[model samples]
Target: MPQNKQIHLDNRPTGEAELSNFKLVVGETPALADDQVLVRHHYLSLDPYMRGRMNDSKSYAASQPLGQTFQGGTVGEVVESRHPKFAVGDKVVGFGGWQEYGVVDANQPGVLRKVDTTHVPLSHYLGAVGMPGVTAWYGLVKIIAPKAGETLVVTAASGAVGSAFGALAKARGCRVVGIAGGPDKCKYVTDELGFDACIDYRQHPDVKSMSAALKEACPDGIDGYFENVGGYILDAVLLRLNAFARIALCGMIAGYDGQPLPIQNPTLLLINRVKLEGFIVSEHMEVWPEALKELGTLVATGKLRPRESIAEGIEKAPEAFLGLLKGKNFGKQLVKLV
Candidate 1:
């Protein structure tokens, strides 16, 4: 049996997640049974949603089990296969977790999928053309339902989902604005991602100041919103919404560390007659094929040119993930396991 390096959840976090909560382990790879395939992960995705799962609380998804490989998305190549649908050397994407390798039952539908990496990089499958891209599509197309010439704003604009959201919105002829943490990220959102404007939230830390920034950037009033960070950002956006504006509440990352961040004035939703909906993209798998189709085209045709921030090895995943939660990573936060 081959030895495998894995990161496991040693303990659940009480308040904020710390490095002590995780432990790296060296273990022997389990033998594959019938209809199983073994994959050697090349890149591992680190996302904010995983933070919520670390709390061992009642959430939309189950908590990450202690003593198991930390759950994560991976893009890799099959190294061994006992399943007829998969073959050795086939590139694939799956929920392979935080490990150098993973095993999947090929008979289980959607657990594993083969991807073509001719035009797109294999790492992109875990980001822009994968879950994050589909997430942006669902929020903007299904929830916000944007109209051309209208103003649309997305927070975390330099991150995976936000960058993809900008591209999708631009393709639709909507005026897109982004709100990122720092000046560099804000600049990338506008200059590289092609967003109409990007506000630096760090400069305007309060709702009043952020609202003023939005007022100047979005003089026409916001027609739609895609929120990733909650707290003051959401509060500020509510003040700038036009009547009947729609909001796609994708992620409230501000509260992911087990903090209480109540929306200051939820009544604004009523006053503006806004349509705000919170969603998990996985729940709406029906839209994946359609969303991935468009996202693939954007990446293949140079429309969605996303950048990435990759850590060197599996041992560095914890540090990379911690940095990601604090908005330290520029674009997609990935760990290069190979």
Candidate 2:
């Protein structure tokens, strides 16, 4: 029998998640029952939203149970199957958690689906052409709803979702500006991702400084904003918002470390008549098909390029995840489990 390696949640983190909060165990793989398929994970996606699930407080999703396998999205291949829909060697993507192998029931809805990796890379499914890509689509197409000649500002611009949003917005004829942490990411956002401009938020440590920089970059004001890293970035963007602007509130990574960072200028929302709304991507699954189609095409055609920060083994998942929360990893953070 093959040994299956799994990481479990050992403790609820009070602040930043540490290695001690997780426990790894190796065990014999269970036998497959009827309509079951055994998948060996090739890559595991580490995302910012997983941080919210670690807390015991109420969230969009249920709190992860202690001792249970830590939840994550995985791209894998079927190694064995008793199900008619899946066959051996088929590539698949699913919520397989932090495990080397996953047993998926064929009858279950929204669990597993075979993916074609011929045109696009298998790992891309976990990032640009997958959930993160769909997340960018939902926020841009559905919420912000930018028109041609408008200005769109995205926070965490070099990240998977933010990069996709910038590329997609630019493709639609919008002037794109990205706010990232450093010079390198800002360069990638403009040079590689083709944004109109990028602001290095590290240089401007305070809201006042950032707002000045934002004011210069967005001379016409921000018509739409895709917020990823909130706190002061949101404050800075709020000050630059055009009348009746739309803001798609995504992950607030700044406040994820147990700090309650409130917006200093909530009045801007009312004064600017900004349509500010927070959204959880999983809650809106109806757009997945359409979003994936466009994202996949853009990626396959070299239009929507997404970068990756890959860690080599399943054992490195905890470290990679911790690094992601701290913005230590660039682009999409993934663990190569195969």
Best by lDDT: 1
Stretches off by above 4 angstroms in model 1 are none
Least accurate 10 contiguous residues by lDDT in model 2: 252-261
Residue-wise lDDT of candidate 1 within 169-250, one digit each (tens)? 9999999999998989988898888999999999999999999999999999999999999999999999999999999998
Residue 180 of candidate 2: its Cα lDDT?
Answer: 89
Error of 1 at 33 (Å): 1.2
lDDT of 2 at 128: 96
Worst 10 residues of 1 by lDDT: 12-21
State the displacement of the C-alpha of residue 108, model 1, in Å, after optimal TM-score superposition. 0.3
Assess each prediction's global lDDT (C-alpha) against the native: 0.94, 0.92
lDDT of 2 by residue, 236-257 (tens): 8999999999999888888887
Clashing pairs in 2: none
